[model samples]
Target: QVKYLNNIVEQDHRRVRQRTRSMLGFKTFMSAAKTIAGIEMMAMIKKGQLNIPGSTPFEQFYALAG
Candidate 1:
């Protein structure tokens, strides 16, 4: 049970790690927070996690941006 739960958590972290790996690192806390939030938002859109009522992820993201 514990191993199963840990795998689930690790999978999620893997996505974040892959995305951030090219950036080297963040210089400030605020910048890191914003960048991570944007990354997560994009990931959610790609995963169809947001219900913005759009046929495509780009449209959904635009709606949220406005």
Candidate 2:
């Protein structure tokens, strides 16, 4: 049962795992944090998880950044 539950949790993070795997790793904690934050933001936008108004994902990301 615990293994099943863990699989569910791992599936949720699959996208993040795939993204980070290609980066080859980070050199600093701050850079890793920033890069992960951006990755999460893009993932959220792609998943329609945020309600920010914008015609495109880039605009929505800009609105959030600005």
**Which candidate leads in lDDT?**
2
Question: Model 2: per-residue lDDT, tens digit, 1-66?
Answer: 575898877876788889999887999999999887887888888989986764699988878767
lDDT (Cα, tens digit) per residue for candidate 1, span 1-66: 575998888776677889889997999999899878777778888777886763677777667655
Q: Provide TM-scores for the models.
A: 0.75, 0.74
- Provide the overall lDDT of each model, using Cα atoms, as 2-decimal numbers: 0.79, 0.83
Which segments of candidate 2 are over 4 A away from where they belong?
1-5
Identify the runs in model 1 with alpha carbons over 4 angstroms from their true place. 1-3
Assess the local accuracy of residue 48 in candidate 1 as a C-alpha lDDT between 0 and 100: 71
Query: How many angstroms is residue 32 displaced in model 2 relative to the true structure, after the best TM-score fit?
Result: 0.5
Residue 25's lDDT within candidate 1 is: 95
lDDT of 2 at 5: 96
